[model samples]
Target: MSDAPREIEALIEMMAKLPGLGPRSARRAVLHLIKKRGLLMNPLAEAMQAVAQTARECLNCGNISTGDVCPICTSEKRANGELCVVEDVADLWAMERSNVFKGRYHVLGGTLSALDAVGPDELRIPKLIDRVTSEGITEVILALNATIDGQTTAHYIADQLDGRVNVTSLAQGVPIGGELDYLDDGTITAALRARKSL
Candidate 1:
């Protein structure tokens, strides 16, 4: 039996289920939190509770927001006639971290996955098309991952918006310091296809 109290062990088990954390890591984390209960644990618990109560998906863009519409969708400065489509809120957040794109976003929730029985109707694809029409979006940038499912979703979205708006995708490429020898054939081919003049 676990030496930890029932509640603490339960917390550790739940934490272990989180991405990137295993049982050992979760145990360490729980110990650290217990040690810093007054400073870290209480505040974290309160914050998580607050977010759990208020966090909701944006009605317009499918982004996680405390309000019905996320701040990005409501911001006047972000209405730049461009929409970046991503497979999930995590991907959207990654793009936001770059701070390069000055447009709004459409979180698809997930890519169309035949294996998992995911379809366009299951995602926010219909809402994306509606947004393109209603928001006067002139360009749709597909910033999906390079996985097969991601590519399939991108192609499907492009076809759906064929004549409506300019559809583009993030360039597939070799990383800044990547060695060609270490790359896969698909990466090399994609890089060659996306080659540009110096």
Candidate 2:
């Protein structure tokens, strides 16, 4: 039904499959790419192709890397006895962007989801336990999202690591610069419970 050429339509269809992009957005993006082919599309295609060839999961921490081990995992400075646990590579990248956590990370890949049949074996949990012992991790910081499945996964990990290492979770409460009135009851309750000396 599309009046566009078959090749252009195919490109638009492929773009539409990306997250947050619909058919209309994909059409617009495809058109933009076509218009800016010389300036943008060629470079983008080359970069994507290069990344596609080089991108691989780090064997140590499950992070996307161009080599066997990511720079963070290989860095001596990152071996600070604290291991930050995240659900996915994106979470790890976000933490890296903040430049706050000085320790290495363990990406679980996903949380325990009964509906989706996800379990410890499905994630990198076994690898996490192995690293805890092998790397002499003193504390494991759970930075999972505040969701039902995320909490469930955190509890499971805590139980698994109960006596071996100290376990902690990221504080869940009102976000920075967030108005109390705009927050939900759960956020208000958590903020009140986690109240600190001001």
Question: Which one wins on TM-score?
Answer: 2
Put down candidate 1 lDDT per residue, 54-162, tens digits, no spaces. 9999999989999999999999999999999999999999999988999999999999999999999999999999999999999999999999999999999999999
| Cα displacement (Å) at residue 147, model 1 | 0.6
- lDDT agreement with native, every candidate: 0.96, 0.96
Which RMSD does model 2 reach against the true structure? 0.9
lDDT of 2: 0.96
Off by over 4 Å in 1: none
lDDT (10s digit) by residue, model 2, range 1-198: 769999999999999999999999999999999999999999999999999999999999999999999999999999999999999999999999999999999999999999999989999999999999999999999999999999999999999999999999999888999998899999999999999997
Q: Candidate 2: deviation at residue 22, Å?
A: 0.4
lDDT of 1: 0.96
Candidate 1 lowest-lDDT run of ten: 1-10
TM-score against native, each model: 0.95, 0.98
* Model 1: per-residue Cα lDDT at residue 83: 97
